[model samples]
Target chain A: MKTHTLSSHIISYVLLFCIGLFLVTFSIYYYFTRSTIQETTKENAVALANNTVNRIELVLNTEERIPEIVAKMLESSFLDRDSLIPFLKSILKNNKNICGSSISYEPNYFPDKGMFYAPYVFRQGSKIRSTMLGNENYEYAFMDWYQIPKMTQTPYWSEPYFDEGGGNMLMTTYSVPFYTYKKRERTFSGVVTIDISLEWLTKIMSTVKIFKTGYAFLISQNGTIITHPNKDYVMNQSIFTIAKENNQPGMRDIGRQMIKGGGNFASADFKSKWHPGKLWINYKGLPSSHWSIGVIYPESEMFASLHQINIILICLIVVGLFLLSLFTVKIIRKLTSPLKHFADSARLIAAGDFNVQLPEIKTQDEMKELYNSFSYMQKELAEYIVSLKDTTAAKEKIESELRIASEIQMAMIPHIFPPFPDLPQVDVFAVLKSAKEVGGDLYDFFVIDGNKFCFAIGDVSGKGVPASLFMAVTRTLVRSISDKEISPSVIVSTLNKSLSSNNESSMFVTFFLGVLDLATGELRYSNAGHNPPVVIRGNGDVIMFEKTKYIPVGLFEDFDYGELSLQLAPGDKIFLYTDGVSEAENVENKLFGEDNLMKVIGENVKASPRDLIHNMEVGLAEHVKGHTQSDDITMMTIVYNG
Target chain B: MNVLVTSSNDYTIVTIEGRIDATSSNEFEKSVMEVIEEGNTKIILDCSGLNYISSSGLRVFLIALKKMKAIKGQLKLCNLQPVIQGIFDVSGFATIFSIFPDQKSAMER
Candidate 1:
């Protein structure tokens, strides 16, 4: 974020920036426009002033030449009085402004060279100075233009003096001094002069235009108004008297500076009966003629449009702000209202209210998707939690039942140590443990008759209470058969036949039974598709009876069971177990296979049955540490005394 | 109200003809202001033909006299009617402004 002045930080900053931009643009435009107007006006003034001054000079010069032409004609020596009179009359008829014309002579006169056409004459005889009207009434010395031209030495334009006697006119006269031949010397002669009315100076300012409320007037180089449309300045009155008379402000100061100040446009604030405390002025001086012209107009009228624009701008800003604020409020409310509802629903969801629902939105936008997703997640989460809880309860009940069934299954066999203490030559220990879900892998050993002992270990194909029940039945049948003095193979055959009878579910067990003669140290075992039993020789060498079998018990009818016989020496051990014992796995998925189990038993073959069992359990445990037990494990060991 | 003054200074007659109403009062004040700006504080206002006086019109004379007094100069008001003078008296402006009966007397003072 850029730092800015405190005042610039506002929502209205945008509006103000826009307004400022517009004003700058407008001011630039107005500046160029005003400059163009002023330039055009100045061009017009210069053109008009120059052209009018030249035209007026030309007109005056042309008119002044009239009387001289007539005088020249009348003074010709060849003209008689009759011809002269007629010639003079024609001159008057053609030139209306020439009330009269004259030809005169005065001796010893030297008129200015440029002042008159004729100059430097002494008195000479036989002159032709004449006037068409009153031709012979007076001597030429008494006439003003005639005498004045003869006495001067240069050309001049006279003041606009009044003339009452000749034509009662305010006029300017043009004169010419002339010479006549006398005794071979050029003698001075009076001048021939004619008057033109100054009031007829329409050429001075030709076709000028001034504003309706403005005035244009002439001022002398001395700041005296020569001619004004107002009749008050008939005499040579300056603003000195006007200021004192009117008691107006700055009138005297302006008059004082008018002559010295080079002509230019200027304004003067004045208090007067005409206008109070307000003035608008413009002035220009004709440098060649030493005459100035001025104009006045009001300043307030110039900026009237600016004031109007200000009002319009203010109104537009007000309306624009009102609309903008209104839009902001409406849009914010529309955008956030739905979000507020969703927030409330989310809080309810947090409180575990599965049935909580949000308001249905009409538009299928992101917000709607969010609301739908929330609802779906809530419903799924509730169902998952309920299912999880129910699963946990069921698991606990099943495990509890498995515990009881496990105990009962163990009780149905001989798990007691030292079952026959009197028979010190015989040692046997067995163990059967069900998995958490309850499985049928059991081991049992008992004395059927006097010197005949029966031992069996079997594994049910499945787990849970069904497999345990099957194990109970199989154990009972094995004990009964062994007591009936049947061979081990016959016992396995009978057990399979009895288990397979009416078995609709196709359930089965892998059974291995053993029969031993105490005096001869002979062990007979029958395997029903079970893992082979491991035997240890008298030299402490372990051998697995990896014999083949036809089928498992309860799998087929009339199946022949296989038997393996071995005579155990006094220090030899025999190990029997189901596949569960060797296949027990840990989290590392390493099974307690037959190789490791055989090594453990062979090394401890000289130990008692309990010690051998203990060594086997420890070896399995060591091999299968940190691993999940995949199946129930059962192991049995027996020691024979020859 | 209108204000008028007719005076003669150095043999030049200064006839202040016409009304000096509230509108013209500004011009009246402006003339006085100019005079003071020029450092000419000695002034005589001959109000002989004055018909009416208003607050706006009198303010010019009051300002002029105040300015003249600060500059250690004098401003004299000559000729006054009872009504015009009454306004001056009520505003306590009579004590501050110098009054004369005629232009000659103002010039003399």
Candidate 2:
């Protein structure tokens, strides 16, 4: 029941469709773009790990070659302990990667030397410093850097440790054993070592960053974290210890893989102590150092750019939808603009403006079709109005003419009250009410002579103009034939004869004629196919003249009528009426029958003729109760006073 | 008003029913005239179901009666309801038209 404008309807549907399409497109775009960013970031992180590992290997390779080459040169040529200091200092000064170089002899290999003997050279700031390393507190022969090569008789890379006795810094040493060729065989004398300070690895690892919070870390071969962005984690925590502290058992697998020199981007996600969110790590092992370089990509930071892109895309889509809705409404309104004009024109036409103009349409679509229909309706309505006006005028003319004819017909009868003014012996009253503009009911009364009065009431059967004309002719015959000498029957017989002469219409009138003698109070009357009349005596006695000896007039030729006579006492009244009086109906179709008519007359018997007839009219109106008068009603009353 | 006409051996019987007022009198006239125009000389009008008749209805009867007279045909009426019989007697139609008590009697006549 609720209604909306056409523009709103169209705009709402368009917006709905557009929103649906955008949602699907956005969902698919977001899904693919997120995965692509993840794949690309993973690839980039792995590649960066490879380049960083290679860079660390380049430093470790030089340190390893320099120490091995120096150890080989010391074996080929016998070098005195005094010459070894220059050799160590020259090596430390020339090779910037080597932080420290040391040579240790077997305890008491020189009979004059003390129990522990090693010469060490290390870089202090920009200067090289030389020192005797073995002392009562510093035992170089018992150190892993010296003991490992002495027992294996091969080169060895040591775990990074703080050399408090020698270099007094955190460093890893690659040591190779040397031989004296006594009996032309190589033998273990002592260890020649190159110490690499871990500070260079930290410098290289610090330059790596994945996205915003992603970072690179280096872990030693024993799973010890060597260099990391988190300073507390660098030298104090191993990879496994950090993993256990963070409750990430998956990180232990990655650490195990890293320590074993199994390098790859990790499949399973893990968390590092350095970050709160989940992290992805790509680790590669350095072949020269047996240490793994790992790049940790925090998952949230890696996809942060993707999230920004999605938000920006969503904003653009929302703005686009808003503008689309606005333009959709405007265009729809423009297309339906002519409908408003047509609606206005329709309203004017409905309000009786049949000639209201309709706007023209250029488009050959439904709008144009509507305009054509409106134009057609307007033209047709205008013509119909013109014809209807003429029809109404013609009908009015006929109605006015009927009104005049009705007046003329009423004038033909004896309408004046108290017809015998001079007689005074007789009182008469009559009323004729027609159902149409003209009627067939007639009543007439006149003084036939000085002592005699003639009165008649008749109803021409059938109604309207034809019956009214018949009634007029019948009245004319009654007036022309009635005389003081003629009896009531003879007068009625003559009237009937004249009416039946050219009665091709087969119409008839129920007529009643009466002549009263003013001196004797004698009345003679004849009825021709009419309801009987009622007579009321002065003594309150009622009588009905029910004799109808002849048929209705104008039905047959030369029909003889019979007369009845009644002697009326003084103040006797005779009431005559047509069937309209008895047959008058009410809303229920019940008639005011003859009994009710007589009852009304008897009740008002004491009233005079005029008052009595008025009472009868009142009784009839009360009985009908506003029902249409179906026929002409005629009533006549004569009171004879002797 | 309903007018039903049927043919017996030599006479046409017309059964008139319901009210025959001024409005319905034209239909009554047409039904009777149609029977008469069919050259049925004898018409037995059955008034058993006739409840009321206005003067206009009486005019149609008069026209029918005059037409019968001109054609020298017999128009008999039977089974008139009391009210209709009273109207007929008062209008003096009872004197001119042949009246019978029943359809069988009218047919015999």
Please name the candidate that would achieve the greatest TM-score relative to the true structure: 2
Candidate 1 per-residue lDDT, tens place, A384-429, comes to: 8789889999988887877777677667878677788898768887
The DockQ-derived docking category for candidate 1 is incorrect
DockQ of each: 0.00, 0.70
Question: Compared with the true structure, what per-residue lDDT tens digits does model 2 show for residues A1-642?
Answer: 428998888888888898899889889988998889888987898889988888888888777887677677767876766798988888887887788888877887667876867888888778899887787777778888788788978788888777675455668888988766657877677778888887777788898988887788888888888887777776689989987888878888889999899888754466554667777778888887678888877778878988898889889989988998888888877778888888888999989987776776788999888888889889988899889999999989999998998998999998888776777788888888999998999989887767777888888988888888888888888888885345899988888888889888788988888888888878888889888888988888777777585798888887788888878888888888898998899998888998899899889878888898899999999999999999999989888888
Residue A353 accuracy (lDDT) in model 2: 86
Give the TM-score of each candidate.
Answer: 0.43, 0.81
lDDT of 2 at A547: 53
Candidate 2 Cα errors over 4 Å, as ranges:
A1-5, A20-28, A35-43, A46-96, A101-121, A124-132, A140-194, A198-200, A212-214, A217-330, A414-424, A483-486, A538-544, A586-588, A598-627
CA error at residue A589 for candidate 1, angstroms: 8.7
